[model samples]
Target: MDVIIARHCVAAGEDGLSPLQRDLIEHPARIRIAEAPTGAGKSYAFQRALRDRGHRILFIVPTRRLAQNLANGLSNDLQDAGWSRQKAAQSVAIWSSDQTAVLRSQGVASINGVRLLQMTDLGSFDGGMIVATPEVVSGLLIRRRVEAGQAGEGVFDMLEQFDHIVFDEFHSIEARGFGLAALFARLATVQLDNRVGFGVSRISFLSATPLDLKPTLVDIGIPEEAIALLRERIVPDGRPLHGDVRLSLVDSPSLYDLVLDHLNEVVEELAAGRQVVIVYNRLVDLEKDLPALSRKLPEAGIDPARVLVINSVRDSTAKGRHQGGFAIGRQRDPLAYDLILATASVEMGVTFRNADFMLMEPGFEAMSFLQRYGRAARRGANGRVIVRIEEQRKPWLRAVVDWVRERPGERSTIAALTQVLSRSVQAEFSPHNTASTFGQLSSQAKWCTALYWSVLLEHASNRQPRRGHLLAHQPKGAGAFYRLEQRVRQLADEPGLTEQVNHWLKLFHAQAFDLRTIEPKIRVVSDTGEAYDYPRVWLQRETEVFERGIETGDEIHIQGGLDDYWREDKDRHAKRDWICHFPHTTRTLRLPCDERLVNRWCDELEDIDPYEFDWEDHPQALEAVQKLVRLTGLVPGHDPEISLDAVSGVL
Candidate 1:
């Protein structure tokens, strides 16, 4: 079968398109769900199809590194399809925040016309390829809908222009991205149908672990036929043969000891002239452990320079060492360094083929475990994997680890693995009501949604759009839409939550609109409601107080007992009609101080700049601030920057 397919497509690898990719091209689906194990050449499947079909493609990935990797990989594929290397480079665009240096350092930017893209640049991105993080695309969709104008229309049109959009690492998508992707797929169906008088647009979701897209797409209002099409299009490929790969677990009381043992083993391997990849889940952990390990390596008779640490926060050197930005794969030459130290940033999509030895701090989820181990044994390389697990994770993660250890050479089908993971997560988090649980939402999704909705509510409140706005997409029902509306209302009605929401909104909008020149005063409000008087003038920075013998940052609860000190301060600082009741430490009682002070402290927190606020500066003042802020409601005023919005045409 492989030989037959390879005969058909001259450009395909010796193994040719996996049966999944082959089926996709032969019988295309409006919404395709394809599955293939890691190192099964998933990247080139769509790359080949789009290049041959001459279709514009939008490739969405989970991380900036993967974006860079896919951009370069696709460019090479384009060149292979008779495009000059320079022409291929010029035809592709990459969009991500603050990744220019990483791109240039990696030579992703050196290719002729490859440009760094932004939300605004989406309008002018008439290139053949687009590589971006799903988060960026989701934000653009939200911004376009809320801030409807020429800019909004431009984004809508740009999205509609894509012939195919591929979501790589589909299992990594959270609720918000999943919702947005499903939404875009629906819109593309309409736009493409209108343009060609039929459904020409194709949406493909590729993942090694299967996800049930029916519920998610249906939740987002995708049509029944589309959902059916997705089910039919699901091409679940068998796992690749991982030769000579052995999986073993190390258990120790202290994680430090576990890592130390692994390092000792790695040093021994390095001394034997074997290549190794050591992956850490946390960059901070790697930074802490690397220094200690490097100090010990000299005694072991191995050059410390042979160790390469790849993290986003490191500095870039000429040899691509200390390169702190997004690394698609092992930045340093695999042959050069006996070991490559990396964080989870390398886990998802990056390929480290030559390194046959892997020391991993096993991640909690099943997909992570698979992807991490999949890094080794690439392109027919035989490898071994060692997972160091802490005592705490032993109880829950042990079963999952055991599952992997039992199947070293054999790979489980995605559907089987998905079932295993679903059970594990359900047992841990939502045993009783697993069906109704808020489906696998990432922290980014929650934060982004909260911020986006706050911006929308604030803008809509000011503009006073028609009562039946597009926001109420669902008829009154107990479903995802109802939950979404409930969340929106909570943001709109609650003061403290609204302020927190606005805080996030302001940061994102600043990036979207380049807000350094604009004053944040309009949207930024004091959490304690005391940053301004009735006229809303910025207050003087209040210095926190620390008395002798008191810790510098203890939280002090104010009882509002009306002592002489309280009376004096109240008389002097309290504003008229501002004695709104804030809750006591216990919500059962009210603290009758000037609510503005507490509100301002909580909302804008003008009294203490969070980033600059020092716990050691004054413990008493820190406690005082927390007591004041905590004495009240769950949310704050979503102060809309009406003037700023009108001027910038974006909220």
Candidate 2:
């Protein structure tokens, strides 16, 4: 549908645009690249664009969690504000990733209407912000949805009518595939298919750490000056729920013990302050020891109400088949639990409006650490993030961790990934890494591979994004080359080469510090079937407290030791203990549902000896069930007449 053909296409009523929204309208970019921090009121930019006279708008992201959250948020905000013309029953639709043809034939799979889509269904929404993952957008532009006949709408045509496209978590783009994001940025800068192609009227990229995307931005066409002006200074944190984040270096310390100690402190604080608490990124290198991880929390005086654990695996599950938000989503509540432990999932889509404290592992992944840190310090409340690491992991950690950390140099992973994606866009193509690497991949596989490639490729490049650093003495008339040379010379004259690198390193560090890598926002919706008064679960993060913290100016780097007995002691109970509540893949039970809808509910309980599926409830099958139950357990007088014992004699 064309913008001219809309049932109503007039900018009507008073939708007073915010200051930033005004900037979006005034300086609308042919290749506009805009970035604002978490609380900087970024959503206003899109709301302004909603008034555009375009046939459609496309909103892209890196994760399904983000897509769902944005869908719900946009719909809720729109309805509450009365811009929503949707029928009550058709308020909005959450497009799931499980809409297979089989499910569609059953009338449950669909892509139209207000939707939540995987990276492959970007074409469903012809003229609205079709919230999607980068993978889906990439597929829309670079590949076909399915083969011919087994057809669906192609985003190719749909991409044309878009007035402006938005990439919210631009920095945390897919590691395995960010073809859509990079392509969008690259084309947002240059026009290929007239306005229909990549320009999409105007493209805006957003993220907490928008700096990490500087190279990609410049490569696209965002003026270096604008990039600087948009991302000026790091906003000082609001008051933290936790005290000053104390990042400490623990050499060869037990990772479990350190986390346990940290968790204990948060629990204590929650109990005392009666505050909801949160722990960010607790799954890294801690999942194994994390199960027994909580056994000692009670010893530290923490209650379950004071703790809520979340991570990425749950996001994967909720992507399909599951509709709960416990594992992932932005949870902000002042009156819920007392402690909140989380992975990167809390940053995008979810807003932490009341949190004010955070504990983070220390490393050079500055933007990420900051985003997680920002979760606590919203609503003008003070907040802090303490980045810590086991000192023992430093040597190997620096080798492994630092290798993958985003840097400011041209050759860094962020740059390379951007360039490769940019070139793919220029050529209008996407990668085939999945088909080549196809296998039963653990959910972690995509991220690990993308991380490794970023380290390996970007570290070898020479491109660099312009940072807000200048030379001590350089003529105003000097070109970029002369200024850069002068700056390098002055730095060379510093105390050491390290000090010289320090200048650029400072800006580079700031870039990484501001990269917007994030876990997709999640919704922890609890299902109650058809019951109206069931206990409801909204994503409300409990506050947490940690002991001993790092002052703002403390050495913001973490050193660790790795020469310890890192064991992978696998145990049976370990499966569900520390990790996510992943359904048992190896087990399957068949349940019949209404023919129109087939739902699989896994009652993992294999069989209860005391009770049977129908041993007593259905007398016909009672004898056979009783006989089978006897092999497992035996009892006397209380036993049914068709008991396996008596059935043995009958046989």
Candidate 3:
């Protein structure tokens, strides 16, 4: 199949307005869902619709980096529209965890002159723009509810103050099990019910590749008719908003090897003065292959300064090596670089207007795949995309490849392409699966809900008022909140358990109910005295390699010994231990800094029983045992023969 799709010259509409821009201006709805192609000006349209209306806008994105980018853009838009620079800066604020920390400590952190504000500041913030991640907004809502012991009236009032709430990249909401999508649905339902009069905030969801979210919204008690779904029409006679992307699919077992195979091609592109972007799925792979790429690029007479690396890692010391890698939150013009290497961090919200070619690993989901591709060929310049797929790992890529092949020489609009890719990964991208994932709360979400509701009930006393709010639409009685309430009550009775529960509650609330177990990270000092933090799990995996290197008398970049560093000062060790243990509640046991002790603790953590816990069967027992572990600082039963009942007395 030829990757190139024939382009046709088409004239823009007489009014030069996209369908979304026209709808926002002429036929505004309370709940609007817009699906448009990348660079179609969806965000700009939404901004323009709300501009001069004196409407308080809450623009929610998936990541903090995107929030920063959008906040900067919005501030600039306000300035371009005739607002003074200082006034525009003051109007556009960022509300994210990092910004929250800064605000709490220093009252403000400026991003491109825009003030970063706290959740408490929202009440007094008048008719301005606030950019945030869903986690930050949802966490604020949940935290307010638990703390105030009511229906979170303070947070709700703050939300009501916003004239419009826009969720950008809204497709990300369908993340499985207690994700922002599900949490937002519940929050939106509650807010809709609680709002009594006019001046309610309009909710708009914007996505380049949108999922069918109407069913999920309706399932969670949102009115079906209230939603206004607007899809961009593929105007055969109209010019494409984005550049025509020529895609090439490559199946390989190793993405690194595949990139190496195409090194000469990359060099050729760079030598031809074309901007190139290479995206890796894993940071480890990027780190490993970067040195080789750097060496070869310089040898090919390409200036080393032209190469730019962007990843999650922030290494100020590596400026001389990679021309100062672009870390998250650090602004740079990506188009300035002749060659770029990045991870998934650059996939969304970041655009490379002048990028002529791209070599990328296939993303896990279809949305991510499209998002990665969308980064290039922007600004109406034709670009080439080469996707390296590990078919054994991502078998869905084969289906997508076959689908494209079956329709050889076909010209597809962005909407049509989205449909084909989404269908290829139906289980993940389908509406049914999205609804199912949203309906079912994870155990951690259930635990948090039960705890919060129990606190709310303590103050409200009447259950009827609380009904139809807070995941009430789910089957089996308001998300089994009552069933889990007893467990929460029992655990609260345990000594110090209330404090522990509150700590965990705050942590989970801040994380937006995401309770994925994260490995403790420790800063490792390299032989060159450069320090970098690595997860304990990664270090554990590398231990064998380190030991084998030591036996063979080979020099290793990372020294296995860390006792000296830990022993340098007692306060240092204490602080490091606190940092490592802060994110966790009951997932692991705390141990001293001895290497042997760390290994033993890791083994013990692995050996602990999972309890086969179901929300319906053992809600009480699971909560009890989890609380017991937190209180006792010990796993209930390390031995397989011991029953959970045997540890009930410990609680």
lDDT tens digits by residue: candidate 3, 58-171: 788776667766777877787888888877776777777667666567754332122213333432433577887765665444332232233334334544576667788766
- Model 2 lDDT per residue over 1-651, tens place: 000100111111245443444555455554454544455556545644543322345676665556666666666665665554562113333333432333566775443321323222432342345565554443333232233333333332333456656677665553223333433443344433343233245566666555344443443233554332243122223211222222223332444544555665555445446343344444444433444645666566665444545556444343222121222222223234455555666666455434544555543344454455445544444333434555445333343234334332212222222232223222322232211111111222222222222221222121222011111111122133233323433333323334423333222112111112332222222222211110011111111000111212211111121112123342222110001010111122322222211111212222423332322343422332222112112111111112323322311
How far residue 96's Cα lies from its native spot in candidate 3, in Å, is: 2.5
1-651 in candidate 1: lDDT tens per residue? 000000011123354655565555544556776655556566676676666655566778876667766777777767776888777776677765435455677877332123313322432333476787765564454443433233223223445566667788777765433444544554444323235212345677776654545444544455546542322222323334344455567766433465566667766666666677878776445655554565665666666566666655332222342222212232343344566777766666876536767878877565676677777765544556777776576433766655655665464443344445456655654344233121343323322233333343343222423122224332112233234334333332433445543443243333322211122221111223211111111110111111111222222222221010111121233222221211111011122224243455354443333453334544443344343224212122222323334423444
Q: What's the lDDT for residue 373 in model 3?
A: 80
Q: Which candidate is the best by TM-score?
A: 3
Candidate 1 vs 2: which has more TM-score? 1
| Candidates' C-alpha lDDT | 0.47, 0.37, 0.54
Candidate closest to the true structure, highest lDDT: 3
Q: Give candidate 2's error at residue 326 in angstroms.
A: 8.0
Q: What's the ranking of the predictions by lDDT, best on top?
A: 3, 1, 2
Residue 313 shift from truth in candidate 1, angstroms: 3.5
Model 1, C-alpha of 312: deviation from truth (Å): 4.7
